[model samples]
Target: MTPPDLAQRLAVRERPPGRPVMKQRWSRLLFLHWRVDPDLLRPLLPPGLHLDLHEGAAWLGVVPFRMERVRPVLLPAVPGLSWFLELNVRIYCHDDHGRPGVWFLSLDCNQPVAVELARNLFLLPYQHARMRYGGELAATRYHCMRHGEEAEAVYEYGPAPSAEVRNAEPGSLEFFLLERYLLFSQGRGGKLYSGQVNHTPYPWVPADCGKWSTLPVKWDGLPEPQGAPESALWVDHVDVHIFPLRRLE
Candidate 1:
């Protein structure tokens, strides 16, 4: 396995050749992450993946965002099916090929069609949820309750007062968390697949997160995190281009 070095991290940001298969706009993204022991995360990964750590500490994130204009390249966005709210529980990981990416434990989306499509077509673990998002960028609120789960995940967040919007600097903790371009998923027979997405580096600011829940992380069977997130970042918007998944060699 290759180490996730600086060059490898930067290399994935390049747009791949060929046409993208889908397009999306992700907005009002709030990323809340906590540093955790790598050992706690190791057993949760599939056989081929290794925890992709920063400073020897694994990171887990609970991200809440709004997805708009999501549709296949050749199709127009359908009004009802296209837009939705999503909250995902994820861990940073790298495959044997040294590709750093997200490994989602559970992705909770409001649209049932989207949940089915993602689970069937992309092999991503998408769960159905009742969700709502409202308020302005400066002060937003999001809530999610996955099907069959008793507790809800709620978040109230916005840009930190007077914080400047900028890209994450290389080798910084922010870069390690927000600059990912690839995602790994497990398909049938325990085989792994990878997909890519290309977008300009996030223009983000430190977030003033309030009243957030650790229930999403607990729902995934992980131990609950104590205290507030070690890092919280927010971005108002980004246009994303998604490529098809390819099986790993």
Candidate 2:
């Protein structure tokens, strides 16, 4: 299948009509990515999604962030239930229709209720975990251990020097990694689904990270990443609207 034009892919900024199914805020986020062989990832994606690549290389990301203000569209946010830490191991993919999105191998969160809702409602791979966060604005530390599993991730990150926050340029690696607007998942019997999300363009900043591990990726069956990550980025925050999932025909 022909890939979507770069302009078409990046033009997805408008929110869907009617009310969103859920609302949330993602803040204090760090994105760590490694370039991997496309062939190694191709077999892992569900049907209808081809591995999305940039400059002839496929990429995988491990992202840690805080989720806040999580609630239904018209409902009040529940105090304790609405906030938590999340870490996900994901890869970039685009369907035959040329829609770019994230394909998660696993999404670990401290909130068990959120994990259950995501797994059952959206058919996502959501796992419960024991997690914690610390540090100031200059540096942040995050840790997570998946419930009933040996897999975990621990890392510290901060903004890089001169970490100017701005929109990523077209055709750049940062654009490829940060501009995705849809999420693809597979349900029972291999039925594919896609959920749309709308948020303003990320004010991305270069990031510096230390004391990191690739346990999540390795636990997902990929080989451990070697050496340093190809890219490390930080985004302060973004208010997100999540639409209901729709079955892909």
Candidate 3:
């Protein structure tokens, strides 16, 4: 879902002779997305997909997913909440030639708090952690942040937007946006988990949210499948994160 033209579009298109070009730059936030098949997930989705939700956290743990949006856009929106947020989750797979993999990326319009946190806490030298295979994405439960791990954070998804998503202090979060997505199913629990990555951007620079970042996500649950029963039954929800960082401007 990485749209190459995004950054280019952010550059000012028209400006007088030597005037400062005002571009619509991102607010130094990272995002993640996932798309699943309804048919495949129907049999797998536990009856209790919604168990406990952390209101203080962000985004609803289970909702709808949109398929049409690009990668960067879907970074903050809650999964399975809308057509714009849902997408086919892709995993990094290497071909015989050792190339990139396939996966999905959601848009960020609904998630405001998590997006803000990422902008504030997603610090420099981006970090990554892999479980080979672990966790349940279909079932809505509080994600384990793994105590003692500063880098590990708990993620939740749902139908509504986060409680506190406004940019309380503008220009607080800044960094390079090195975003990546990986999808995998837990071999033990048959739970699907998608890995979303973000690194510090171009060292770091503080920027205001009003002019730099994205609009808060818009939540809309999935519509009834129009294609076929198989298609409708296979889709499960997704797991995502908005990774942001801080650095000197």
Best model number under TM-score? 1
Report the Cα lDDT for residue 97, model 1: 74
Cα lDDT, all candidates = 0.92, 0.88, 0.23
RMSD of 3: 20.9
Which is the winner by lDDT between candidate 1 and candidate 3?
1
Tens-place lDDT per residue, model 3, 1-249, is: 222232332221212233221111222121332233334333322321211111211111121232221234425433433222211222222122221212222223223333343233331111122111122333222221121233322233221222222221212211011122212222224332322232122222121111111111111123222221111111222223222211111
Worst 10 residues of 2 by lDDT: 7-16
Cα misplacement distance, residue 172 of candidate 1 (Å): 0.6
Which of the predicted structures, 2 or 3, would earn the higher TM-score when compared with the native? 2
Q: What TM-score does each of the candidates earn?
A: 0.98, 0.96, 0.18
Better of 1 and 2 by TM-score: 1
Which 10-residue span in candidate 3 carries the lowest summed lDDT?
208-217
Off by over 4 Å in 2: none
Residue range 1-249, candidate 2, lDDT tens digits: 666669757765567676789999999899999999889899999779988888789999999999999999989899999999999999999888888889999998999899999999999999889999999866899999988767567889888877677998978889999998889999889989999999999898988887677888876778989988989999989999999998887
